[model samples]
Structure formats: C-alpha cells, structure tokens
Target: MLGFFFALPNALPADTRAKMPGMFQRTINLGLDLQGGAHMLLEVDLTSVLEQALENEKETIRQEFREADRLRTETIRVDSENDAVIVRLRDAADSDRAFALLRDLSKPVDPTSISQDKTTRVEKLSEKDFRVTITEANIADIQKRTIAQSMNVLRRRIDPQGTTEMTIAPEGDDRILLQIPGAKNVDDIKSVINKTANLSFNMVRKESNNEAAMELARRPGSLSKVPPGAAFYPEEQGGGLIVERRTKITGECLKTSSEGLHPEGNYPIVNFTFNIRCARLFGDLTQKNIGQRFAVVLDGVIITAPRINGAITGGSGFIEGSFTLESARELSLLLNAGALPAKLVIVEERTVGPGLGQDSINAGKIASMIGLAGVGLFMWLSYGLRFGTIANIALTTNIILIAGALSLMGSTLTLPGIAGIILTIGMAVDANVLIFERIREEAHLGRPPVNAIETGYRRSLAPILDANITTLIAAVTLYFVGSGPVRGFAVTLAIGIVMSVFTAVVVARLITATWLRRKRPKTLPI
Candidate 1:
C-alpha cells in the first residue's frame, strides 16, 4: 500500500502517457552542437613577448652602466613603438668609451646581426660632435615562448566554465589555436580576453614643474604614462596610473551576489557577499575610513568612489556603478563566474535559427515516446500482467528519478541526454526480473507465501547489489573520464541504478507483502 503511493508518481497517466508536474518536472538543456552556436579558436599577441624580453635586457644594460660609472656621458632608452633599446653618448669626449660599455652590455644578448650608423655635427663653439648608433639582432627570439604563455593564460582564464570537452591550447610557434563549441557571441568573449583588465592604484603626483616631472618619471616606484602623440590622446580623467595591486579579497571569494536597489535608495547596485577574509578586510577598511573616498575600480576606471561612512565586517558590499538593471545583472554573473585565468579572445562565431532548435526538440520528444512505448510493451508481453506491471512501475521510477537528479545537479539535458534516459528504462528492469525469478522458484518449491517471498528476496539481495555496484563503479569512472555527451549517459545510468534498486526491491516487496497479508494464496501464479 505504501509502495503503491510512492510508485504511483512514476507511472504515466493512462490516456496521455505524460508525467505529472508535481511528480516529475524536467527542463531540457541544449548542447552547443544541436543549438548551433559559435566555435572559437583564439591566439595571444606575441609582440608583447618581445617587449618583455627587451625590458629584461634593459635591466642588464643599467647594471653595466652602474659598473662602469662613466654614464655622465650616456643614456639608455627603449623606443616607445619599437622593441629596441637605444644607448647614446651624451658627451662627445665619452663617445668611444661609452660605445665600449654598450658593446659589453649587449655581449650577453645573442644579437643575430649588428649595424652602426655614424653622424657628426658642429657644436655651438664649432667643435665636431660624433655619435654612433647600433642596432641589435635578437629581436625574434622570444616570439614562440611569449605566444605559449599567452595560450596558457587564455586556458586559465576560461577554466571557470569547467568544460573539459572544449580544447584551448597552443598550436605552434607564435600561434595559439583551439576550439570551444556552443559559445555564441564571439565578440563578447574576445572583448573579455583582449581587454587587459589590469588595474592599479597610485597616489596622484603634481605636474607643475619640469624637474618634478622628470624626477617623478625617474622614480623606481612611480609609473609614468607617456604624453599624447599623433597616435594617442591625453587621459580624460587624469592623474597617476600604476597596476592596481588586487585587494586581499577579490570577487572570487564571493559566495552569492545579486543586483538590487541601493539601501540609500538612489540608483541600481550589485550586492555581494564574501567569505571570512574578504569580510574582515572590507569591514576594517569601511570602519577606519569613515569619511575618506575609496575608489571602486574595475578593469581600470574608477566606477565608484563612495565615502567609507562605516565599517562593513560582514563580508558584504555593494558595487554601485553607473549600471542599469540589465548591466548590473550581467556584471553579477561575471563576478560570480570567478575571474578568468587570462583574457579570452573569440576567434569564431555563429548563431542558430529558432527553427533548428524546435526541430531538435520535436525529434527528441518523438524518439523518447517511441522508445518508452517499445520498452513498456515488451515488459508486458514477456513477464505477463502482474510481474510485468511491477517491472514497468520500477522502470517508470527510474525515469522520474533521473529527471529529478538532473535538476538537482543543475545539468542541462540535451538530445543525447534524452537518449541516455531512454537507454536507462531498458536497463532498469533487469534487476526486477532477477528478484522475481528467484521468488517464482521458491513458490514453485511449495513453500508458504510469506516464507517464499522473504527467502527469495534474501537470496537475491547479494547478486543484485553486486551487479549494480559494479555497474556504478563503471558509470562513475566514465562520468569523470568521458567528455560531454558520454558524461550524460554515465549520469543517467548511475542514477537509474540507485532508483531501480529502490523501486524494484522496496516497492515490489511492499506490493507483494500487501498481497500475502490479504489473501494468503497457496498456488503460485508464475
């Protein structure tokens, strides 16, 4: 009686064969392939590689200058546009000596080729001034490795998706090529990776005096932005810029974040909660600086610079940007997704028509109906009414539980996933047959109804659990090792196994127990 109540939910309504909403509700998730989205292959810029290598060489050049102590005559500068380092003599008398130092400094660098240009000019007092310009050759050395690092960063940045099936790796020297399926909006993804969201906080410096500007530019701690030339424009909201050292707490530490109206009641805001560490730091910062403005900077721009009116030790804070409701929600998703490993560059894109998605849904539904009908009919014909009906009940439970499990796990169920569910229906009935046959044998031996039922189940328990346990082990292994669609199959199989056991052993036993208690029939049916 109890089992019937439980089992009834699994059975389909007689006329329509549709599931009850409250009994089993499921939403199908579409795969990238079936849904028709963009596939991407992105490569990182390799020129940044050359610049970094040159910067390293600059440090070496500085050391050599310090060692010689003759730099009252020479200056070293990296060209803003090109990846070249220039060493020039300031005093005409030190030209030859400075050239000697330049050679020594550049000796460690494996320059492929070297060339020099000489020029002479008459000084103000009519003295001849001569200078030598040399160009080093090892410009192309770092290209391959730089691209490799960029590919790695891209891989790291994209890891938040937790997609093992998608490939993002290096191709060859100076190129990174790989594919991610089902991702629409290639431009959006490209924007994420291409935008170097490097942020920093630096104290504002006075720009009044030339000497001060020079001194500030020379400071080891201060980073200077180049003045606008023909190619670039001046900073709109200007002051100082250095890479913002991230807060001890980042968006990653957040547990849950949502968009809402600000408590002060003016504009849209994003409310976020962080773990213990973030909360402690945020609370302290808010408490101590009750009136000072702390900038809420993202990517680079100072989006919000609200005053710290009070402490916020609770690990919750509002990101009140110039965000509309939609943008606020989108930002919330990005923060919730955690930070990307590097940046993402979308090298591919496409969109699927609604017609195609609808076609897939129809095909999947028809296939499911056919598979269910075939399985149900076969069970009835093979086992006869009483036994077959119980097996069908168990099969029905298997489907319900699979749907419920999918919902709980937050997995999207695509067409391949639906195929897995249909497969599970056939597989779920095997255990019930094993137990039923064991009971039939006991009843045929002329044992009393109660003794036969108990004995049959007792004997069947070990084999049934062992069989399902072994299958479960395989299912779990596949779930971890296999990619997208295979994983769906594994999940359905594993869930069906557990649910099959419950419905077959527990539900069937309850029905049998009720019958034995009511009628106490002596003759066996099967």
Candidate 2:
C-alpha cells in the first residue's frame, strides 16, 4: 500500500498529483544533469563592501560631530588608499575628546569575551590630524555577513515561490553557487540576481538648472563645472536631472510595493507604500517643499523627477517611467526582495538544453534496464526454477523499495544515481548466491532441507551485513565530502545498500519459509 502511494505521483500529472495528500505527493526530483536548468557561479564584490563600510563610517563621524558640541572636527574624509578615515580636528585641544567619542562608537568583540577586538583603531597622526583604520577582524566579519545576506536576497529574487527545485549556497569565501532545475529563462534569472535594487529619494538642487545638468551629463569634461553638493543623473526618458547628494528616504523605509498601471496615462508603474514614520516624514517634506522636484533614484540612476504640487499625507506613491508590464513586475519583485548588500558578478554561467537532458535520461534508462536484465537472467540460470524464481522476486522487490524510498525522501536522481541502481542489482543477487552455496554445502552434508535452509541464512547473514556496512560507510563519506552529482550518487548508493539488505535477509527468507510449509519438500533443490 505504501509502495503504491509513493509510486502514484510518477503516474499522474503534476497538477493532479499535487492535489493528493502530502504523504502521497512526494516524487523524486531530477538533478540538473537529468533535467535542463541554469547553473551560475556568482562572486560577491567584497571590495565594494569594504568601500561602502568606509563611507558609512565617514558619514557616522560627520553626524557624530554635528550632534555633539564637544567633538568638533574641521573635515572628515575617507582615504581609499589607506583604507581608513582621516579626521582633522578644528582645535588640537579637542583631539582627546574626539578620539574618546570615536572609540566609544567602535563595535565590541563580544559581551562575555574579555578580548577587545575594536572595529576601528584611532591613531594620532599630528596635533590636529587623526587616522582611524578599520580593523582586519571587522572586514572579515563584514565580508562573511554580506555574502550570507546576498545569497539570501538572491534566493528570494530567483525563487519567490520556493517550489522550484533550486539550490543557492555559498561556494567559497566570496562566491555563491546557484543551480535551478528545469529553468527555462536563464537571462531573466541572471538579471534578477545581478540587480542591486538600491532605491532612494533625493531632492533636486535648488540652484541647479536643466541646461547645466544636460551639459554635464552630455560632456564628461563639464563635470568639474557642476555645482557643489549636486550631481547629474541620466533621466529615464532622456536628458539629465541634478539632485542633491543626500537622500531623504531609502528603500529600507518601504513597507510594500506592487506593479500597477497609472490611473491617468495607463502606463505600467511600481506603486509603493512607506512605513508610518517614513510616511509622516515624506508628508512633511512634501508639505514644506511644495513645487520643488524630488528625484526617484534606483541603483544610482534617476528614474523620475516629479514635482510636488501639494502636500501628500497618504504615505503612498508610484514611480513613473517608461516601463513595460514585465519590467514593472520585475522591479516590484526586486523591491519586495530588498536590496543586496553588495554587487554580484557572474563569474560563470552554464545552461543545459532540455533535449540534451532528455538524451541523458534515455541513455541512463537503457543502461539500467540492460544491467537489470543481465543480472536477473544470471540469477535464474544459476539457481534452478523455484529457488531462482524466489531470488528474482526479491530482486524485483528491492528495485520497487528503492524507488519508493527515493520518492519518500524526495532525493534527486542524477545520471550517476541511475548507475548506482544498476550496481545494486548485482549486489542484491550476490547475497542470494552466498546463501544458495551455503545451502548446497548443507545438503551435501546430509542435513534436512528445512535445517539446511535455516542454517544457510543464519551463516550468511554476518558476511552480508559486513560487506554492505563497509560500502554504506563509504557512501556516507562520499556524501559529506563531495558536491553536485557526487552527492546524488552517494544518496542512491546508500539507499540501495539498505534496501538490498532488507530484501535479501527478510523478504527472501519469508518466501523460502512459505514454500517449505506449502510443499514440505523431502530434499533441497540444490
């Protein structure tokens, strides 16, 4: 009954099969080698993470001095070459106070640990100059955390439903491995994974004009002439818009976002709702800066610059740009997934065509059938009709149980996994061969048929267990140390070993017992 339940999913269509109860719905998933999919190796830009950290530290220092009257500094700048922040104090007398404040802000190693692994080290460069270097420990910790966060964001963006058989895991220190089985659109997946999706709202510079912005945007040489505290960003449609460097709202403030069509123009747009605090803050900003334009920035490019006609208190707004339905939906999906901590570069990409996968599956199926038939024929010929038939029944049962077990566990079957199944056919019959030989010896020794049968099973049990256990250990080790197809092979090999033991010892023994009771043979077939 359990075997029937497990095997049902393979016979029904996916939609109809899913309607069944959970216990009966599980089916063996095919691996990428057997099912077409996209394979990608992404490397996280760790240098960007460190640079962003430095910029954040610089901003924090600026904000700290602005908030604290006692800690005053002339200038705070990030020195990329030195990988540190340089702070110039207005007065040398305030250096000690500034250093103390910065030290207090440094991250502690742990609450319970006595070791002091400060995030920053403040060194006195001169009377008024101080150099703050980020610690190696902090960089390592940030890199680790950022990679983990990026992987999670990538997973959410690539497999929102989580039903697709996808694997996203850390490959190395700064690389991630992604495998999606049966993926049709590889480019779309790549685009979704690569997008940083950093969204922000910055007000337009009051003194900046479209003429100056356009000139700066068109001619790279005119960049130096652009006004201070303002930068030009390419507009979505065309031209450019100059906006302030400081952002008033960021993507983190967004509570929800969805794709929708504009009410007036009927063009696709991404509608967003902000959290209560950001909503109130946005309302006040719009109310105070009426008639002024604010730029909606996505990943540093200005998507739109809409003027505030009146105060907006609803906390809801939509971004307007030249967007198709698909692009708008993708944009909303990214916003919902949240932004990645660092940029991801595609180090490697591979796509397996469905036709090729089908070919491999067919080849594996043919090899498996050939192996099974050869093994079955050998067992039937070596042992005469009744005993050979018994061994064949156990062998057939072994295959069914292996399939049922794989289905029950939801294990992926790769090409190599099919090879494991074929190998199991021989191993299953090998145990029966040992038992049959032992029975023949007992019969030659003048033992009764029933006694010979019982002794044959009892004497062969230890050796069979010893051989399968050793192989099982090897399969487990392979699973732990290997990846991809190697792991798939390990899964099937281990399961086959287990099922073979059951069918050989228990199933075959029961069949022999039933035959003995029904026929009451005077002499053994051997």
Ten-residue region with minimum lDDT total, candidate 2: 220-229
Computed on alpha carbons, the lDDT of every model, listed in order, comes to 0.58, 0.86
lDDT of 1: 0.58
Give the clashing pairs for model 2.
none
Candidate 2 lDDT, 1-526, residue by residue in tens: 4865786687689999879998888888887888889999999999999998898788777777879987678878889999999999999988788878888778864556687787888888887998888898788889889988997888888888877767677787899988889999988787788788999898988655757766766874677666644567777777777787656588878998999999999989999999999999999989999999999999878898989999989999999988999999989989988899998999999998888889998998788788888887887788888888889899988888888888998888888888888888878887899899998899899999999999999999999999999999999999988877788889999989998898889999999999999999999875
How many pairs of residues in model 1 come into backbone collision?
Answer: 14
The RMSD of every model to the true structure, in order and in angstroms, is 12.5, 4.5
Q: What's the TM-score of every candidate structure? A: 0.55, 0.80
Residue 187, model 1: Cα distance from true site in angstroms: 5.2
